[model samples]
Structure formats: structure tokens, C-alpha cells
Target: MSEVPTTRPARGRPRDPGIDARVLPAAVAELAEKGVSGFSTRAVAARAGVDRRGVHARWATSEDLVVDALATLTANLRPPLTGTLRGDLDDLVPDVARALSGQRRRVLQRCLDEVGDAPAITERFRRDHVDRCTAVLEDAFHRAAGRGELVAATTPARATEVLMGSLLLRALTVGDDAVRGDALDGVVDHVVALVSTSAPGARS
Candidate 1:
């Protein structure tokens, strides 16, 4: 007798690409509004206008969804390149300041708070947010070097650290008002001055 062939049943409707687009933004909005403690798959599904099953199908848990959503948001933010290092760095300051404050800040704090429970989420956040930011600055520095605008001793990582650290401090300690005011301008000016001073053939 010939062997019989078997076929498995389909696992429900095909996944919708548009659902992902809607769900990611909805997840971010939910986290911004409700925080980790209040965030739920049901709420995200409702917000996205997708079936709860769709959300669960894509993500195993609310934490997973949150991590993915935050990653999506961070990945979309690229530092502007204005053909000059100072111009590019200046262009990035306001956005960096904005990210460190407001709803984004609260969402970040909540992520930190939940790190013990979701270490993977923390790692993903670091890779998605911190690493990407560093990469952008590093690229800018390399471009400056290629243009002979940066000194041999200038370190992209160190410069990124200094600029980001200062902005974070201002955002977390002095508040967003400082970030939005002349303080931000002062910080950008200081970084630019430091870079200019350290550049090749700069006046001491």
C-alpha cells in the first residue's frame, strides 16, 4: 500500500503587516500613558484596533511588546548630517534633549524600574537606544575626520559619552525646562567649542 500524506491545518489568518505598524505605535503610546505597571496586552490591542490574538501572536508578553515598540521608536531617530560636524551636532541637540524628557523620559524610567524582571528588555533597550546613538555620533566623527575637521586624538566614543551624559544630566536633574532653554544651547556650544579646540590645526 502507498504511504498516506498528511497536511497540517493553517494556524489562523495570515499575519497583517499593517497590524505591526499600528501595534508598535500603539504600544509606545500605551507605555507613555500607562507605564509598565499599567500596560497590558489587552490595552495595546484596543489601542491599536487589532485583535488581542494578533498582539499575543507576535509577542509572547507585554514586556516583549514594549521592548520591540521602544526599539522601533529609537531605530527611527537618525542624527541629521549638515555637511559640517558642528552643524550636525547642533542639529542633534534638541532631539536628544526632547528624548530625555517628557513622555519618553517616563517610559524610560519605567523600563529601568522593570529591568530586574525583564533584563532582556533592558539589554535590547541599550542596544537599540544607546548603541544606535553612539553609532550615529561615531559616524559623524568619522565623517569629520575624513574632512580633516577632527584631530588625530579625538575619540568618537568619548565625545558621544560627554555630549549624551551632559544632556541626560540636564534632563534628569535640572528638568526639561532647562533642556528647552538656553541651557541646551549652552551645552551644545560647549561641546562644539571643545570639538573645535581639539580639531587639527586649531588655535590654542
Candidate 2:
């Protein structure tokens, strides 16, 4: 008679759900403080008060970790709906300006530098950021159309690119100072006017 194979308990302890909470924030802090150069599993683990294995258990590489951390940082940056698209965009301008400035600016620059080496990470970042912004703009446009505040010809993708592109350009060129005071308001007003005019039956 064949002997029955013995079953053994799984190796290693069960994964802690709390590990992610600790790891991600630590990763963000690391990126914020050290940028991409200092972003490593070992460093993040130390910051999070866990073993390096804990970070590896969650992310395959530093690029993966960075993407997730950046995603978390920008997760709440979506524009709020204030009934009208203009109002929604106006409300979001200050936050957008803030994001493009300060520590976030350094974080973004580091990510951009790393993108050449990590195409996958770049794609993930674009999806998390650009795609999300496009979706938010699309929803805003839809709402505006329903309210007869926008034209059927308006395209969210184009509009999102315009808005994001302008912010990025300003951030890169004139730095944070250009995005403050009346400058930030001016950008918002310009974007709103352009979007409004792009609607049907509106003056160019």
C-alpha cells in the first residue's frame, strides 16, 4: 500500500495587512526626503520599522514602490464638483498649484528622471495620474453638458491635456513662484474660458 503524503503547515507567518499601511507611507517619506536615489527596499523597510523582506513582499522593485507611493500622494488631487465645470476647475487650481510646487515638485522631478530607466513605472505613473485626471475632467464635462453649461463638441481628453500640460509647463519653467498669487488664478481663468468657448454655440 502506498503511504499517504503528510501535509505540512505553510512556511512563513501570514502577511500583515498593516504592513502596507506602514510600508507605503514610509516609501513616500523616503521618496520625499531622498528622492529616487535613496528609494530602496532596505531604506523603506527601515523607515517603516519592518524587515526588507516586508517591502519586497509587497513590491518587486524600487520602481514599483515609487509608483505606488506617488499614486498615494496624488490620490486625493481630483477636482471637486461644484455644479459647474468652471467652479469645479477653479476650486482645484490651488491644490494643483500646491502639488506642482514644494516637496511634491522634487518628488515629481525624481520620478521623471527615473522614467527613462523604468518604462513600466512611467506607464503606471501616467495611468495613475494622467488617466485619472482625464477621467475627472470627463465627468466634469458630462455634468456641465447635462446642465447646458458646455457644448456637446467638448472633449475631455483634449481639455485635460491642455490643463495638465499648462500646469506642468509652468511648474517646470517658472517654478512654484509663478503658480502663486494672481498667476494661479490667471491660469485657472484662462483654462475655464478656453473650455467654455470650446462648447457648442459659444464664441471662439
Candidate 3:
């Protein structure tokens, strides 16, 4: 009689739990230097010092890979809330500003430059980045409104755009180093003032 062969195949080595910690940042670095058009798994593999299989095994599409990479950069933009809207904004707003500089700024610039040609990337940006920001702001703003810290009319969309855009503007216009920590104080103060002085008639 012939011996029966085992039906189940041998399992491969267990995946490195820290592969994301390595690949995502490398993907962002590739995007910063090459933009979307030039972005490639091979380049990222070389930069990350891992086989292309490691990256591809994790992310099936470039869009998927890039969005996850961008997520890592944007992940820390949110700060812990202090209940009071002003205190929350004090930390949250500055955190957003600080993140908009340096290599992260380059990543954003590359995304903006090439995203128009890539609808998949555009949708990913909205789903992963824009929508996340809006959701967080909506929670913060509505909570503040419930407590009478912000006007009931406060619109998270316009406010999110304004606050986030202002911080991003500095990095785009004057480079990352130009975004001063002190200047962010003014942004928070002005927004708080808008709620106070114009709360009744505020559009957002």
C-alpha cells in the first residue's frame, strides 16, 4: 500500500507584525520623492529594504498601499479632547499645523499634483483623509454646541476647511519651517472669537 500524502500545505513563516511600521513610511518617502506617477512597488521595496512580495502581499493595489501610507502620516493629527472646545482646538489645531510640515508636506504636495489624474487616489484621499477630518470635527463641534461652547450654527465642513487650509497654506507658500508655533495661537483665538462675536449670525 502507498502512504497517503498530507492534504494541508506547510504554512509559510509568520508575517512580521512590524512590516507596516516599515513599509508605510517607505511608501510615503517614495511618494514624496516621485509623486504618484513615479510611485512603484519596486522603488518602495528598495527603499524599505524588503522584497516586493512583502509590500504586495499586504496591499493588492497601489492606491490601497498609498492611502494606508498617507494614513500613517495623518494619524496623529487628532489630539485628545479636553471637553472645552477651546482647549481641544488649542491642541487639535496645532497638531494639524505641525503635521502639515516637513516630509508630510511633500507627500501632500505630490498627492495634490497627481490626484486629478487618479480618481482612485482622489476617492481614497476623501475616504481616508478628508472624511476622517470632517467626522472628528463634527463630533467636536456638535459636542461644543451641546455645551454652548460653539454656536449651534457651526458647520464642520467650512470650519474644517478653513482651519486645515490655513495651516496647510503656510507650508505650501513658505516651506515647512515657516509655520510658526506662535502663529497657530492666533488661528485658535480668531476662531474662538468668531464663535463669540458672530455666533448668532455665523455661517460656520
Best by TM-score: 3
lDDT of 1 by residue, 50-90 (tens): 99998888998877898788875452447677888888877
List of clashing residue pairs for candidate 1: none
Q: What are the lDDT figures for the candidates, one per model?
A: 0.76, 0.75, 0.73
Q: Which has the higher TM-score value, candidate number 2 or candidate number 3? A: 3
Model 1's TM-score against the true structure: 0.75
Q: For model 2, where is the 10-residue window of minimal lDDT?
A: 195-204
Model 2, 1-204: lDDT tens digits are: 998869877789767789889998888888877767666778889889998886787788888888888877563556587987888877766776777887777788777777776678779888877577557766776676677665445566666677778888898788898788888888877776776755445653
- Estimate the overall C-alpha local distance difference test score of candidate 2: 0.75
Rank by lDDT (best first):
1, 2, 3
Which regions of candidate 2 fall more than 4 Å away from where they truly are?
1-18, 32-38, 75-79, 145-154, 197-204
lDDT of 3 by residue, 55-102 (tens): 788899888888888887673556457877777777676557666778
Indicate the residue-level lDDT of 167 in model 3: 69
Measured with C-alpha atoms, the lDDT of residue 44 in candidate 3 is 90
Alpha-carbon runs more than 4 Å astray in model 1? 1-11, 14-17, 33-38, 75-81, 146-148, 151-154, 198-204
